[model samples]
Target: MASTLHDVARLAGVSIKTVSNVINDYPHVRPATRERVEQAIAELGYTPNLTARSLRSGRTGAIALAVPELGLSYFAELAASVIEAAEEAGVVVLVEQTGGDRDRELELLRSPRLKMTDGLIFSPLGMGQDDVDRLDVPYPLVVLGERIFDGPADHVTMRNIEAARAATEFLLRTGRRRIAIVGAHEGEVIGSAGLRLRGYREALDAAGVPFDESIIGYTTLWHRSNGARCMRELLDRGAEFDAVFGLNDTLALGAMRVLQEAGLRVPGDVAVVGFDDLDEARYSIPSLTTIDPGREWIAATAVRTLLERIEHPDAEQPARLLLADFRIAERESAGAALDSASAALESAGAILHQGAGADA
Candidate 1:
């Protein structure tokens, strides 16, 4: 038979209520008392019955994570990270995929299944500012993405505009003019697509480079397929471009493949850069220069925030906004030639030094 709460309470020389308090992470419990309770629970191998606990506290030992699509590498990685963090907190996670469709996303917001979990971590792609009011539901919630800022919940997101600006400026500093941007939203003004496009324009404007609308490729999705299709369309239009900036690493890899199919050498004919420092980005042919947008931090923080809200409901909910720090992952795609030339120069200089040492 498994050890019970009574066993933990008896071993700790405390009442069952005190043991329950400690298990629930009640802040008012004294440190020494909490430690004794924890040690007792550990020694007795007592695992609290989640169903019984739920009946008493009305909180399931699970949380919900709803994302647009886990098929995307970035989201898949994020979901894994969230699950890891939640496990550390002694909680289970229930994941839901919205397919990035507006109807499905909205329907999920009103999901009866939400009541089964303690809270939700939502990363919405379809809902916008107009749907902010609808998020004022009963459950504790943390919102992700740039679709609706200043919403009535804790928000965690990457600094898309700032990161995008840094990526575009990097390409410009590499002496790549006539840079074409893949994964642009046609009329979006607040989402990731729009924010990144705005950033690219800012970089070009700062460098005194004229913005050519013809060079911007529009896509409804940010998938690899969308990137390839958009690149092909751009090529057919016969627009001149010296480099491609993909909004995400997947898109960048797709565009790189299509560029190669057209017999253009990467970084020789057209340098390539991307966002999202995915695991696959490092293994792509020529490797990809991309942005590491602090994804792990975002995942950990989102889980932590949701748990805090769930555990401390009476605590002031101040609609906190968190942005992930971003850095460029320099790789072979954009600066391969420059790196190879530097390596050759170093080798030549080493040979010259060896000869000089021999003469001496």
Candidate 2:
């Protein structure tokens, strides 16, 4: 037999209505009374019947989260953060992965399975600006990622251009002039790769450093294997680069591994930097200096915004474009070590030797 709401009320010496108020999170409940009710519920090991509560509230007390791929560290961490935030709000999260396929993403938008939850938080990768109309769903939907902006739903994403610019500027300030880029998509202009590549170009233009296309490595995916392959190609082509900027940490780590295999010292032969401050980035060899793109805030904001939409479906609030602030996580991969006098001398000596037609 399971303890009921009446048992909780009896243990707390309160009315059934009072216990219900606390469980339902009514804002007017007195602190002492709410605490007493909560303590009693804990003591009795009472669990609220979600089905019964849903009958009265007309809400399933659950939300759906759809992402491109959980195998990717950034998406994996984002999902974990979303789950944490939903758990804190006493809501359940059903996760779905689309493998970054456009057709699957469109199908997910129209899927009848979404009726099980009150709202959805979607992160699409394969679907681009062309699929913007598909986002006008009839539910409380919050869209994440760098795709299909200004749609009919609330959007939560990072400032990719500004953050990528900051990352590039950081490398330049470290006395690196010939910076190579990994994980670039060929002829792209709207996705993450395009936006971030634009930022890198902006930084170079501001610093009066001419962009070198030869050192720009193109990849179809942002995976470690792609990063390694890109770096190898750049090396084989004899692209002269003093620093490498990987679009993401996984790619950066992969490129760094390849650089080591080629007997090049990181930050000594070629300083390295990456984006997406993943937890694994902190534990990698020499650690990764990357961008902390406020993924946790994005998750929390997405949940809160979705809940607001769910609570006030007819409130006529216009869709919002919420952008998360980002900062560079300075670590060993491209840290103060590069600013040392010896490193500065080494870079200057290499440049001087090259100018004098001498082998470095």
Candidate 3:
């Protein structure tokens, strides 16, 4: 009882081959004809027969996306963006969460469920650089996150060190000499915490400010609860800091809540900044000044890169590392001083471009 390709072609006044070309997203299809075919499809409620299409095209018409927890706003938003990009290309996305567990992540890499998809976009949290060999799967794979770099697959990630440094320097330019940090992992040197901490230190050194560890709030996770607890601990210990830099927006928002609970005014008594310019950042009281790490661009690029591999599996190009450019999203929490900093970056020719690193 379902409408077939022939029905769509008849309705659109086109040949079956033209309708097929439009359905397959072939670039050569004329725009007006494609529109007519699409209208016919929408009117008839036609559903694509993916199984038969796969048999003819030698592809599953689907891709898998694996991320560390969807509960985290960052990952959820990233997944949404990936799904949107895939839909634009007429492809389906299968999402999976790994809970950031090393064992689960390893098991997912070999999971038979992936056989139904043509390629994968993987973001691993618990896996480290030492476990890079596990990424050498037979499918077309594109890697995301700061955990494992120089892997066998193409890597797509943000410039953590540079972006974090820009965030710290923004606080310094606001005349906040004593800046506290939230969500730091003690003794870490490679993950997000380590790279962001390195950037913070680099900014302090560049500004001739001495690095003081007493005000640093270390936490095992970057959750809002951990941020609040970390802030409370700093207050209990009497750490004197004029500003707070939460590693992420959720942490910053949590710290801000505690700061107000303790009768401190934001940007009046203490300034605050965070990373991962989440949607909630804009709606928060006084709003949050944070780093926009080009998340949407990263998602789109990851999907496109994976499709390239899927379409040309035998291409001889080496694995590439694509890095996203970041910018400071000026808001009320960090004060008006950000205007000058943004101007400086613009004047210095800080153009947004996704640069490719040396092939690994």
* TM-scores for candidates 1 onward, in order: 0.82, 0.83, 0.84
RMSD of each: 9.3, 8.3, 5.2
Q: Give the 10-residue window scoring lowest on summed lDDT in candidate 1.
A: 351-360
* Model 2 CA lDDT for position 233: 96
In model 3, the clashing pairs are none
What TM-score does structure 3 among the candidates reach? 0.84
lDDT of each: 0.86, 0.88, 0.89
Worst 10 residues of 2 by lDDT: 351-360
TM-score of 2: 0.83
Q: Model 1 over residues 286-321: C-alpha lDDT tens digits?
A: 899888887888888899889999989989757788
Of 1 and 2, the candidate ahead on lDDT is: 2
Clashing pairs in 2: none
Q: What is candidate 1's local distance difference test score?
A: 0.86
lDDT-based ranking, best first? 3, 2, 1
lDDT (Cα, tens digit) per residue for candidate 3, span 1-360: 898899999999999889888987999988999999999999999887878788887789899999999999999999999999999998999999999999999999999999889999999998998999999998899999899888999998999998899889878876788999999998988888899999999999999999999999999888999999999999999999999999999999999999999999997888899999999999898799888888998999899899999989999888999888788887789855546665565445433233344224
Q: Name the candidate, 2 or 3, with the larger lDDT value.
A: 3
Better of 1 and 2 by TM-score: 2
